[model samples]
Target: MNFATRPNFEAISSAPVMQRARGTARIGTKQRDGKTCIDTLFQEGCGKIRLPRTHSSALEAVFINTAGGITGGDHLRWGADIAPEGRLVITTQACERSYRSTGDTAHVEADINVGADAHLDWLPQETILFEASKLDRRLTIRLDEGATLTAIEAVLLGRDAMGEEARDAQFSDTWRIFRGDRLIHAEATRLTGDGSERDGLSLLRGCRAFASILHVAPSADRAEQLLDRVRALHPAAGLIAASANGERLVIRAMARTGLALRKLLVPTLIELTGAGSLPRLWHL
Candidate 1:
Protein backbone atom coordinates (compact mmCIF):
# COMPACT_ATOMS: atom_id res chain seq x y z
CA MET A 1 0.00 0.00 0.00
CA ASN A 2 1.26 3.49 -0.85
CA PHE A 3 1.23 6.10 1.98
CA ALA A 4 1.09 9.85 1.63
CA THR A 5 4.09 11.91 2.65
CA ARG A 6 3.51 13.99 5.87
CA PRO A 7 5.36 15.30 8.91
CA ASN A 8 5.00 13.57 12.29
CA PHE A 9 6.29 14.48 15.73
CA GLU A 10 9.27 12.59 17.09
CA ALA A 11 8.67 9.77 19.57
CA ILE A 12 10.67 10.06 22.82
CA SER A 13 9.34 7.10 24.91
CA SER A 14 7.33 3.85 24.90
CA ALA A 15 5.78 1.15 27.12
CA PRO A 16 6.80 -2.35 25.97
CA VAL A 17 3.59 -4.02 27.20
CA MET A 18 1.14 -1.26 26.23
CA GLN A 19 2.49 -0.46 22.76
CA ARG A 20 0.42 -1.04 19.67
CA ALA A 21 1.47 -4.23 17.91
CA ARG A 22 0.66 -3.02 14.36
CA GLY A 23 -0.91 -0.14 12.45
CA THR A 24 -4.30 0.15 10.83
CA ALA A 25 -6.10 2.99 9.03
CA ARG A 26 -9.81 3.79 9.00
CA ILE A 27 -11.86 5.26 6.19
CA GLY A 28 -10.69 8.62 4.73
CA THR A 29 -7.23 8.55 6.31
CA LYS A 30 -3.62 7.48 5.77
CA GLN A 31 -1.85 4.63 7.56
CA ARG A 32 1.52 4.39 9.33
CA ASP A 33 2.60 0.88 10.26
CA GLY A 34 3.68 0.81 13.91
CA LYS A 35 3.54 4.61 14.21
CA THR A 36 1.44 4.24 17.36
CA CYS A 37 3.57 3.26 20.36
CA ILE A 38 3.08 3.11 24.19
CA ASP A 39 5.99 3.48 26.59
CA THR A 40 6.32 4.18 30.35
CA LEU A 41 9.17 6.17 31.88
CA PHE A 42 10.49 6.61 35.39
CA GLN A 43 7.95 9.29 36.41
CA GLU A 44 5.39 9.02 33.61
CA GLY A 45 4.22 6.78 30.76
CA CYS A 46 3.46 7.70 27.13
CA GLY A 47 0.53 6.18 25.24
CA LYS A 48 -0.17 5.77 21.53
CA ILE A 49 -0.26 8.91 19.34
CA ARG A 50 -1.63 9.17 15.81
CA LEU A 51 -0.86 12.25 13.74
CA PRO A 52 -2.15 11.77 10.22
CA ARG A 53 -1.96 14.41 7.54
CA THR A 54 -4.76 14.52 4.94
CA HIS A 55 -4.11 16.44 1.76
CA SER A 56 -7.62 17.09 0.46
CA SER A 57 -9.34 17.12 3.87
CA ALA A 58 -8.63 17.92 7.51
CA LEU A 59 -5.82 16.29 9.46
CA GLU A 60 -6.58 13.99 12.44
CA ALA A 61 -4.62 12.91 15.53
CA VAL A 62 -4.88 10.90 18.80
CA PHE A 63 -2.73 10.60 21.93
CA ILE A 64 -2.89 8.05 24.75
CA ASN A 65 -0.87 8.42 27.96
CA THR A 66 -2.37 6.47 30.83
CA ALA A 67 -4.65 3.61 31.92
CA GLY A 68 -6.06 2.04 35.09
CA GLY A 69 -6.38 -1.47 33.72
CA ILE A 70 -2.57 -1.55 33.31
CA THR A 71 -1.76 -1.14 37.02
CA GLY A 72 0.43 1.96 36.55
CA GLY A 73 0.11 5.62 37.46
CA ASP A 74 -1.41 7.66 34.61
CA HIS A 75 -0.34 11.13 33.48
CA LEU A 76 -0.81 12.75 30.06
CA ARG A 77 -0.16 16.08 28.32
CA TRP A 78 -1.20 16.73 24.72
CA GLY A 79 -1.47 19.73 22.45
CA ALA A 80 -2.22 20.51 18.82
CA ASP A 81 -0.93 23.51 16.88
CA ILE A 82 -3.08 23.68 13.78
CA ALA A 83 -1.35 25.87 11.27
CA PRO A 84 -3.47 28.42 9.45
CA GLU A 85 -5.66 26.73 6.86
CA GLY A 86 -5.31 23.40 8.69
CA ARG A 87 -8.04 21.37 10.43
CA LEU A 88 -7.86 18.38 12.74
CA VAL A 89 -9.75 15.98 15.07
CA ILE A 90 -8.48 14.06 18.11
CA THR A 91 -9.67 11.15 20.34
CA THR A 92 -8.42 8.36 22.64
CA GLN A 93 -8.71 4.57 22.86
CA ALA A 94 -10.17 4.35 26.41
CA CYS A 95 -11.15 6.20 29.55
CA GLU A 96 -8.31 7.25 31.85
CA ARG A 97 -8.56 6.01 35.43
CA SER A 98 -6.63 7.84 38.16
CA TYR A 99 -6.08 5.12 40.67
CA ARG A 100 -5.33 6.05 44.29
CA SER A 101 -2.71 8.80 43.87
CA THR A 102 -0.44 7.25 46.45
CA GLY A 103 2.35 9.60 45.38
CA ASP A 104 0.62 12.69 43.96
CA THR A 105 -2.61 13.66 42.23
CA ALA A 106 -2.78 12.31 38.69
CA HIS A 107 -2.22 15.29 36.42
CA VAL A 108 -3.06 16.18 32.80
CA GLU A 109 -2.54 19.40 30.91
CA ALA A 110 -3.99 19.99 27.42
CA ASP A 111 -3.07 23.00 25.34
CA ILE A 112 -4.54 23.80 21.94
CA ASN A 113 -3.64 26.62 19.58
CA VAL A 114 -5.85 26.91 16.53
CA GLY A 115 -4.56 29.23 13.82
CA ALA A 116 -6.66 31.59 11.75
CA ASP A 117 -9.34 29.83 9.68
CA ALA A 118 -8.32 26.54 11.30
CA HIS A 119 -10.56 24.10 13.16
CA LEU A 120 -9.70 21.71 15.99
CA ASP A 121 -11.63 19.10 17.91
CA TRP A 122 -10.12 18.10 21.30
CA LEU A 123 -12.37 15.17 22.05
CA PRO A 124 -11.08 12.41 24.30
CA GLN A 125 -12.76 9.56 26.16
CA GLU A 126 -14.14 9.85 29.68
CA THR A 127 -12.04 9.72 32.88
CA ILE A 128 -12.93 7.68 35.96
CA LEU A 129 -11.87 8.35 39.54
CA PHE A 130 -11.30 5.37 41.81
CA GLU A 131 -11.43 5.12 45.61
CA ALA A 132 -8.96 7.54 47.28
CA SER A 133 -7.69 8.85 43.93
CA LYS A 134 -7.12 12.53 43.22
CA LEU A 135 -6.80 14.36 39.89
CA ASP A 136 -6.07 17.95 38.91
CA ARG A 137 -6.61 18.98 35.28
CA ARG A 138 -6.07 22.25 33.46
CA LEU A 139 -7.22 22.79 29.87
CA THR A 140 -6.11 25.91 28.04
CA ILE A 141 -7.34 26.67 24.54
CA ARG A 142 -6.58 29.61 22.30
CA LEU A 143 -8.15 30.34 18.94
CA ASP A 144 -7.39 32.93 16.36
CA GLU A 145 -10.24 35.04 15.04
CA GLY A 146 -12.53 32.88 12.87
CA ALA A 147 -11.06 29.65 14.25
CA THR A 148 -13.41 26.98 15.69
CA LEU A 149 -13.07 24.31 18.38
CA THR A 150 -15.14 21.67 20.17
CA ALA A 151 -14.09 19.94 23.41
CA ILE A 152 -15.66 17.21 25.54
CA GLU A 153 -14.96 16.26 29.15
CA ALA A 154 -16.57 13.36 30.98
CA VAL A 155 -16.07 12.03 34.52
CA LEU A 156 -17.26 9.00 36.44
CA LEU A 157 -17.21 8.06 40.07
CA GLY A 158 -15.75 4.82 41.49
CA ARG A 159 -15.81 1.75 39.22
CA ASP A 160 -19.40 0.58 39.38
CA ALA A 161 -18.84 -3.06 38.44
CA MET A 162 -16.18 -3.29 41.13
CA GLY A 163 -18.67 -2.02 43.71
CA GLU A 164 -16.23 0.76 44.62
CA GLU A 165 -17.92 3.97 45.72
CA ALA A 166 -16.42 7.50 45.77
CA ARG A 167 -16.89 7.82 49.50
CA ASP A 168 -13.19 8.56 50.08
CA ALA A 169 -12.06 9.94 46.72
CA GLN A 170 -10.93 13.46 45.71
CA PHE A 171 -11.08 15.02 42.26
CA SER A 172 -10.76 18.54 40.87
CA ASP A 173 -10.78 20.07 37.38
CA THR A 174 -10.36 23.56 36.00
CA TRP A 175 -11.11 24.74 32.47
CA ARG A 176 -10.27 28.01 30.78
CA ILE A 177 -11.25 29.21 27.32
CA PHE A 178 -9.77 32.11 25.46
CA ARG A 179 -10.42 33.73 22.09
CA GLY A 180 -7.64 35.74 20.53
CA ASP A 181 -6.28 37.32 23.71
CA ARG A 182 -9.33 37.50 25.96
CA LEU A 183 -10.76 35.05 28.45
CA ILE A 184 -14.28 33.92 27.61
CA HIS A 185 -15.05 31.16 30.09
CA ALA A 186 -13.47 29.79 33.28
CA GLU A 187 -14.80 26.96 35.46
CA ALA A 188 -13.54 24.83 38.34
CA THR A 189 -15.05 21.80 40.08
CA ARG A 190 -13.80 19.75 43.00
CA LEU A 191 -15.18 16.62 44.69
CA THR A 192 -13.95 15.61 48.12
CA GLY A 193 -15.32 13.68 51.11
CA ASP A 194 -16.18 16.68 53.28
CA GLY A 195 -18.75 18.18 50.94
CA SER A 196 -19.66 15.09 48.92
CA GLU A 197 -22.95 14.55 50.73
CA ARG A 198 -24.11 18.15 50.47
CA ASP A 199 -22.63 19.28 47.17
CA GLY A 200 -23.50 16.01 45.52
CA LEU A 201 -27.12 17.03 45.52
CA SER A 202 -26.34 20.23 43.63
CA LEU A 203 -23.89 18.58 41.21
CA LEU A 204 -23.98 14.79 41.01
CA ARG A 205 -27.57 14.43 42.26
CA GLY A 206 -26.96 10.82 43.28
CA CYS A 207 -25.55 10.03 39.85
CA ARG A 208 -22.26 8.20 39.38
CA ALA A 209 -21.54 9.54 35.88
CA PHE A 210 -21.33 13.16 34.70
CA ALA A 211 -20.26 14.79 31.43
CA SER A 212 -19.91 18.22 29.86
CA ILE A 213 -19.63 19.05 26.17
CA LEU A 214 -18.71 22.55 25.01
CA HIS A 215 -19.09 23.59 21.40
CA VAL A 216 -17.99 27.05 20.29
CA ALA A 217 -19.05 28.60 17.03
CA PRO A 218 -20.28 31.88 15.60
CA SER A 219 -23.84 30.61 15.91
CA ALA A 220 -23.71 29.83 19.62
CA ASP A 221 -27.34 30.82 20.05
CA ARG A 222 -28.43 28.05 17.75
CA ALA A 223 -26.28 25.65 19.73
CA GLU A 224 -27.88 26.71 23.03
CA GLN A 225 -31.34 26.32 21.58
CA LEU A 226 -30.36 22.88 20.41
CA LEU A 227 -29.15 22.04 23.93
CA ASP A 228 -32.45 23.26 25.38
CA ARG A 229 -34.29 20.83 23.15
CA VAL A 230 -32.06 18.00 24.33
CA ARG A 231 -32.56 18.86 28.01
CA ALA A 232 -36.26 18.91 27.47
CA LEU A 233 -36.05 15.43 25.97
CA HIS A 234 -34.17 13.89 28.90
CA PRO A 235 -35.70 13.27 32.33
CA ALA A 236 -35.34 16.33 34.59
CA ALA A 237 -32.81 14.77 36.96
CA GLY A 238 -30.81 13.11 34.22
CA LEU A 239 -29.45 16.10 32.30
CA ILE A 240 -28.97 19.87 32.27
CA ALA A 241 -27.67 22.57 29.86
CA ALA A 242 -27.03 26.29 29.42
CA SER A 243 -26.09 28.94 26.86
CA ALA A 244 -23.09 31.27 26.66
CA ASN A 245 -22.47 34.56 24.75
CA GLY A 246 -24.58 33.36 21.80
CA GLU A 247 -21.54 31.57 20.33
CA ARG A 248 -20.81 28.81 22.87
CA LEU A 249 -23.00 25.94 24.09
CA VAL A 250 -22.38 24.08 27.35
CA ILE A 251 -24.37 20.98 28.26
CA ARG A 252 -24.08 18.94 31.44
CA ALA A 253 -25.58 15.54 32.25
CA MET A 254 -25.75 13.07 35.13
CA ALA A 255 -27.10 9.55 35.41
CA ARG A 256 -27.52 6.91 38.11
CA THR A 257 -25.43 4.72 35.81
CA GLY A 258 -22.72 5.45 33.24
CA LEU A 259 -24.64 3.98 30.33
CA ALA A 260 -27.64 6.11 31.13
CA LEU A 261 -25.78 9.41 30.89
CA ARG A 262 -24.02 8.43 27.67
CA LYS A 263 -27.26 7.46 26.00
CA LEU A 264 -28.64 10.87 26.81
CA LEU A 265 -25.68 12.93 25.55
CA VAL A 266 -24.62 11.04 22.42
CA PRO A 267 -27.72 11.77 20.35
CA THR A 268 -27.77 15.40 21.40
CA LEU A 269 -24.14 15.91 20.38
CA ILE A 270 -24.62 14.17 17.04
CA GLU A 271 -27.63 16.33 16.31
CA LEU A 272 -26.01 19.57 17.39
CA THR A 273 -22.45 19.22 16.08
CA GLY A 274 -22.93 16.65 13.32
CA ALA A 275 -20.03 14.72 14.81
CA GLY A 276 -19.75 10.96 15.18
CA SER A 277 -20.26 8.96 18.39
CA LEU A 278 -17.53 9.14 21.05
CA PRO A 279 -14.64 6.65 20.81
CA ARG A 280 -15.07 3.06 22.03
CA LEU A 281 -12.60 3.66 24.87
CA TRP A 282 -15.11 5.78 26.79
CA HIS A 283 -17.42 2.86 27.51
CA LEU A 284 -14.78 1.07 29.59
Candidate 2:
Protein backbone atom coordinates (compact mmCIF):
# COMPACT_ATOMS: atom_id res chain seq x y z
CA MET A 1 0.00 0.00 0.00
CA ASN A 2 1.17 3.51 -0.74
CA PHE A 3 2.08 5.53 2.39
CA ALA A 4 -0.16 8.48 1.44
CA THR A 5 -3.18 6.25 0.76
CA ARG A 6 -2.87 4.13 3.91
CA PRO A 7 -5.03 4.88 6.99
CA ASN A 8 -3.31 6.18 10.11
CA PHE A 9 -4.00 3.20 12.37
CA GLU A 10 -1.55 4.39 15.03
CA ALA A 11 -3.28 7.76 15.53
CA ILE A 12 -6.72 6.14 15.51
CA SER A 13 -5.67 3.66 18.19
CA SER A 14 -3.97 6.28 20.33
CA ALA A 15 -6.97 8.59 20.48
CA PRO A 16 -9.03 8.24 23.69
CA VAL A 17 -12.70 7.38 23.56
CA MET A 18 -14.97 9.27 25.98
CA GLN A 19 -17.51 7.33 28.02
CA ARG A 20 -20.42 9.21 29.55
CA ALA A 21 -22.81 8.14 32.30
CA ARG A 22 -26.56 7.96 31.54
CA GLY A 23 -29.36 6.56 33.67
CA THR A 24 -33.02 6.83 34.67
CA ALA A 25 -34.83 6.06 37.92
CA ARG A 26 -38.61 5.99 38.24
CA ILE A 27 -40.85 5.21 41.22
CA GLY A 28 -44.62 5.08 41.88
CA THR A 29 -46.50 4.80 45.11
CA LYS A 30 -49.84 3.28 46.16
CA GLN A 31 -51.96 2.80 49.24
CA ARG A 32 -51.33 -0.44 51.13
CA ASP A 33 -52.46 -1.40 54.62
CA GLY A 34 -53.75 2.13 55.05
CA LYS A 35 -50.23 3.48 54.39
CA THR A 36 -48.43 4.56 51.29
CA CYS A 37 -46.04 1.96 49.83
CA ILE A 38 -43.88 1.53 46.81
CA ASP A 39 -45.93 0.30 43.86
CA THR A 40 -43.44 0.24 41.03
CA LEU A 41 -39.73 0.99 40.64
CA PHE A 42 -37.44 0.96 37.65
CA GLN A 43 -33.74 1.78 37.61
CA GLU A 44 -31.14 1.39 34.91
CA GLY A 45 -27.46 2.09 34.30
CA CYS A 46 -25.87 4.40 36.91
CA GLY A 47 -29.17 5.29 38.60
CA LYS A 48 -30.22 3.46 41.77
CA ILE A 49 -32.92 3.74 44.44
CA ARG A 50 -33.21 2.41 47.98
CA LEU A 51 -36.12 2.21 50.43
CA PRO A 52 -34.73 2.45 53.93
CA ARG A 53 -36.80 1.43 56.94
CA THR A 54 -38.66 4.37 58.44
CA HIS A 55 -41.34 4.90 61.05
CA SER A 56 -43.26 7.57 59.21
CA SER A 57 -46.49 6.76 57.41
CA ALA A 58 -45.16 8.03 54.12
CA LEU A 59 -42.92 5.94 51.86
CA GLU A 60 -39.36 7.20 51.48
CA ALA A 61 -36.99 6.82 48.54
CA VAL A 62 -33.28 7.62 48.30
CA PHE A 63 -31.63 8.17 44.94
CA ILE A 64 -28.02 7.25 44.21
CA ASN A 65 -25.71 8.01 41.30
CA THR A 66 -23.17 5.22 40.92
CA ALA A 67 -20.99 7.30 38.59
CA GLY A 68 -19.74 9.23 41.68
CA GLY A 69 -19.92 12.70 40.10
CA ILE A 70 -21.20 14.47 37.00
CA THR A 71 -19.07 15.98 34.23
CA GLY A 72 -19.55 16.95 30.62
CA GLY A 73 -21.95 14.78 28.57
CA ASP A 74 -23.47 12.98 31.56
CA HIS A 75 -27.30 12.66 31.70
CA LEU A 76 -29.48 11.66 34.66
CA ARG A 77 -33.25 11.61 35.10
CA TRP A 78 -35.59 10.85 38.00
CA GLY A 79 -39.40 10.52 38.14
CA ALA A 80 -42.05 9.81 40.73
CA ASP A 81 -45.86 9.32 40.73
CA ILE A 82 -48.07 9.23 43.76
CA ALA A 83 -51.39 7.42 43.62
CA PRO A 84 -54.59 8.90 45.00
CA GLU A 85 -54.41 9.51 48.75
CA GLY A 86 -50.79 8.31 48.84
CA ARG A 87 -47.83 10.00 50.50
CA LEU A 88 -44.20 9.93 49.39
CA VAL A 89 -40.85 11.47 50.34
CA ILE A 90 -37.85 11.50 48.03
CA THR A 91 -34.21 12.42 48.75
CA THR A 92 -30.72 11.78 47.43
CA GLN A 93 -28.16 9.53 49.03
CA ALA A 94 -25.59 12.33 49.10
CA CYS A 95 -24.78 15.76 47.74
CA GLU A 96 -24.22 15.79 43.98
CA ARG A 97 -20.88 17.20 42.80
CA SER A 98 -20.28 18.69 39.38
CA TYR A 99 -16.67 18.55 38.22
CA ARG A 100 -14.87 20.46 35.53
CA SER A 101 -15.99 19.82 31.98
CA THR A 102 -14.20 20.12 28.68
CA GLY A 103 -17.13 20.84 26.36
CA ASP A 104 -20.72 19.72 26.81
CA THR A 105 -22.65 20.42 30.03
CA ALA A 106 -24.11 17.80 32.36
CA HIS A 107 -27.90 17.54 32.49
CA VAL A 108 -30.38 16.41 35.17
CA GLU A 109 -34.19 16.26 34.93
CA ALA A 110 -36.90 15.48 37.48
CA ASP A 111 -40.59 14.93 36.67
CA ILE A 112 -43.08 14.29 39.44
CA ASN A 113 -46.86 13.77 39.55
CA VAL A 114 -49.17 13.97 42.52
CA GLY A 115 -52.61 12.33 42.38
CA ALA A 116 -55.85 13.41 44.03
CA ASP A 117 -55.40 13.96 47.76
CA ALA A 118 -51.78 12.74 47.50
CA HIS A 119 -48.70 14.43 48.93
CA LEU A 120 -45.04 14.45 47.95
CA ASP A 121 -41.95 15.89 49.59
CA TRP A 122 -38.82 16.35 47.49
CA LEU A 123 -35.75 17.16 49.59
CA PRO A 124 -32.68 16.41 47.59
CA GLN A 125 -29.26 17.29 49.02
CA GLU A 126 -27.34 20.31 47.74
CA THR A 127 -25.36 20.33 44.49
CA ILE A 128 -21.74 21.56 44.53
CA LEU A 129 -20.09 22.98 41.45
CA PHE A 130 -16.32 23.12 41.03
CA GLU A 131 -14.33 25.51 38.88
CA ALA A 132 -15.15 25.41 35.16
CA SER A 133 -18.11 23.11 35.68
CA LYS A 134 -21.31 23.43 33.68
CA LEU A 135 -24.69 22.03 34.72
CA ASP A 136 -28.26 22.30 33.45
CA ARG A 137 -31.10 21.05 35.61
CA ARG A 138 -34.90 21.19 35.43
CA LEU A 139 -37.74 20.08 37.70
CA THR A 140 -41.40 19.81 36.67
CA ILE A 141 -44.26 18.85 38.96
CA ARG A 142 -47.96 18.25 38.25
CA LEU A 143 -50.51 18.12 41.00
CA ASP A 144 -54.21 17.41 41.25
CA GLU A 145 -56.47 20.08 42.69
CA GLY A 146 -56.52 18.23 46.04
CA ALA A 147 -52.84 17.27 46.14
CA THR A 148 -50.01 18.85 48.10
CA LEU A 149 -46.30 19.17 47.36
CA THR A 150 -43.17 20.48 49.07
CA ALA A 151 -39.81 20.70 47.32
CA ILE A 152 -36.35 22.11 48.02
CA GLU A 153 -33.39 22.72 45.70
CA ALA A 154 -30.06 24.05 46.98
CA VAL A 155 -26.70 24.79 45.33
CA LEU A 156 -23.21 25.66 46.52
CA LEU A 157 -20.47 27.23 44.44
CA GLY A 158 -17.76 25.41 46.40
CA ARG A 159 -16.88 24.17 49.85
CA ASP A 160 -15.63 26.91 52.14
CA ALA A 161 -13.53 24.65 54.37
CA MET A 162 -11.75 23.11 51.38
CA GLY A 163 -10.80 26.59 50.10
CA GLU A 164 -12.29 25.79 46.75
CA GLU A 165 -13.93 28.31 44.43
CA ALA A 166 -16.05 28.06 41.30
CA ARG A 167 -15.14 31.47 39.91
CA ASP A 168 -15.52 30.16 36.37
CA ALA A 169 -18.71 28.13 36.18
CA GLN A 170 -22.02 27.94 34.34
CA PHE A 171 -25.29 26.79 35.91
CA SER A 172 -28.96 26.92 34.89
CA ASP A 173 -31.95 25.75 36.91
CA THR A 174 -35.67 25.79 36.07
CA TRP A 175 -38.72 24.78 38.05
CA ARG A 176 -42.34 24.56 36.86
CA ILE A 177 -45.34 23.59 38.95
CA PHE A 178 -48.89 22.99 37.76
CA ARG A 179 -52.24 22.13 39.29
CA GLY A 180 -55.09 20.75 37.18
CA ASP A 181 -53.72 22.09 33.93
CA ARG A 182 -53.06 25.55 35.32
CA LEU A 183 -49.50 26.74 35.89
CA ILE A 184 -49.23 27.99 39.43
CA HIS A 185 -45.50 28.65 39.82
CA ALA A 186 -42.50 28.97 37.53
CA GLU A 187 -38.89 30.01 38.17
CA ALA A 188 -35.71 30.17 36.17
CA THR A 189 -32.15 30.85 37.38
CA ARG A 190 -28.99 31.24 35.34
CA LEU A 191 -25.42 31.97 36.44
CA THR A 192 -22.41 32.34 34.18
CA GLY A 193 -19.15 34.22 34.62
CA ASP A 194 -16.06 34.74 36.72
CA GLY A 195 -18.42 34.98 39.78
CA SER A 196 -18.07 38.73 40.27
CA GLU A 197 -21.64 39.32 39.09
CA ARG A 198 -22.83 37.55 42.26
CA ASP A 199 -21.90 40.70 44.16
CA GLY A 200 -24.87 42.53 42.66
CA LEU A 201 -27.52 43.47 45.22
CA SER A 202 -30.23 41.61 43.34
CA LEU A 203 -28.07 38.51 42.90
CA LEU A 204 -26.43 36.25 45.45
CA ARG A 205 -24.86 39.31 47.08
CA GLY A 206 -21.55 37.67 48.09
CA CYS A 207 -23.19 34.47 49.33
CA ARG A 208 -21.60 31.22 48.20
CA ALA A 209 -24.68 29.10 48.89
CA PHE A 210 -28.37 29.53 48.11
CA ALA A 211 -31.61 27.54 48.09
CA SER A 212 -35.28 27.71 46.99
CA ILE A 213 -38.18 26.12 48.80
CA LEU A 214 -41.72 25.67 47.47
CA HIS A 215 -44.89 24.48 49.20
CA VAL A 216 -48.27 24.03 47.56
CA ALA A 217 -51.60 22.98 49.00
CA PRO A 218 -55.21 22.89 48.03
CA SER A 219 -56.25 25.58 50.50
CA ALA A 220 -54.62 28.99 50.87
CA ASP A 221 -55.09 28.68 54.60
CA ARG A 222 -52.73 25.70 54.73
CA ALA A 223 -50.10 27.59 52.79
CA GLU A 224 -50.44 30.61 55.05
CA GLN A 225 -50.13 28.45 58.17
CA LEU A 226 -46.89 26.91 56.96
CA LEU A 227 -45.52 30.32 56.05
CA ASP A 228 -46.34 31.61 59.48
CA ARG A 229 -44.65 28.63 61.14
CA VAL A 230 -41.49 29.14 59.07
CA ARG A 231 -41.39 32.80 60.03
CA ALA A 232 -41.73 31.88 63.67
CA LEU A 233 -38.71 29.59 63.45
CA HIS A 234 -36.52 32.60 62.65
CA PRO A 235 -33.39 30.80 61.49
CA ALA A 236 -30.48 32.24 63.49
CA ALA A 237 -28.15 32.19 60.45
CA GLY A 238 -28.35 33.09 56.77
CA LEU A 239 -30.59 35.64 55.03
CA ILE A 240 -34.06 34.14 54.64
CA ALA A 241 -37.32 35.45 53.20
CA ALA A 242 -40.75 33.87 52.78
CA SER A 243 -43.68 34.85 50.65
CA ALA A 244 -47.13 33.51 49.86
CA ASN A 245 -48.91 33.64 46.53
CA GLY A 246 -52.44 32.29 46.48
CA GLU A 247 -52.18 28.63 47.39
CA ARG A 248 -48.38 28.48 47.15
CA LEU A 249 -45.64 29.53 49.56
CA VAL A 250 -42.04 30.19 48.52
CA ILE A 251 -38.90 30.79 50.57
CA ARG A 252 -35.47 31.98 49.42
CA ALA A 253 -32.30 31.84 51.47
CA MET A 254 -28.60 32.69 51.08
CA ALA A 255 -25.59 31.98 53.25
CA ARG A 256 -21.80 32.02 53.27
CA THR A 257 -21.52 28.22 53.62
CA GLY A 258 -23.54 25.05 53.23
CA LEU A 259 -23.86 24.54 57.00
CA ALA A 260 -25.43 27.94 57.51
CA LEU A 261 -27.83 27.39 54.64
CA ARG A 262 -28.94 24.12 56.19
CA LYS A 263 -29.60 25.82 59.51
CA LEU A 264 -32.10 28.02 57.71
CA LEU A 265 -33.52 25.26 55.50
CA VAL A 266 -34.14 22.48 58.00
CA PRO A 267 -36.82 24.20 60.05
CA THR A 268 -38.53 25.64 57.03
CA LEU A 269 -38.60 22.26 55.35
CA ILE A 270 -40.01 20.62 58.44
CA GLU A 271 -42.81 23.14 58.60
CA LEU A 272 -43.67 22.81 54.94
CA THR A 273 -43.54 19.02 54.86
CA GLY A 274 -45.32 18.66 58.19
CA ALA A 275 -43.32 15.50 58.73
CA GLY A 276 -41.82 16.69 62.00
CA SER A 277 -38.44 15.38 60.72
CA LEU A 278 -36.64 15.12 57.42
CA PRO A 279 -35.61 11.99 55.60
CA ARG A 280 -32.98 10.05 57.57
CA LEU A 281 -30.49 10.54 54.74
CA TRP A 282 -30.42 14.27 55.52
CA HIS A 283 -28.66 13.55 58.78
CA LEU A 284 -26.09 11.36 57.05
Which numbered prediction scores highest in lDDT against the true structure?
2
TM-score of candidate 1 against the unseen true structure:
0.73
Error of 2 at 172 (Å): 0.5
Q: Compared with the true structure, what per-residue lDDT tens digits does model 1 show for residues 1-284?
A: 99997654344244233331122222122213412111211222454465534332555465655343322234566665666645566777667776765545666777777777666667777788777777778889897887776777887787778876676677778899888998877888777756555246666667778888787775666656765775666665546565565677777777766677678777666544323443334444
Q: Residue 172: error of model 1 in Å?
A: 1.2
TM-score of each: 0.73, 0.95
* Range of the 10 consecutive residues with the lowest summed lDDT in candidate 2: 193-202
> Which clashing pairs does model 2 show?
none
Please give the lDDT score for candidate 2.
0.89
Which candidate tops TM-score? Answer: 2
Runs with alpha carbons beyond 4 Å of true place in candidate 1: 1-47, 51-56, 66-75, 195-199, 220-225, 228-237, 274-284
Note the clash tally of each candidate. Answer: 6, 0
Model 1 deviation from native, Cα RMSD in Å? 13.2
lDDT of 1 at 273: 37
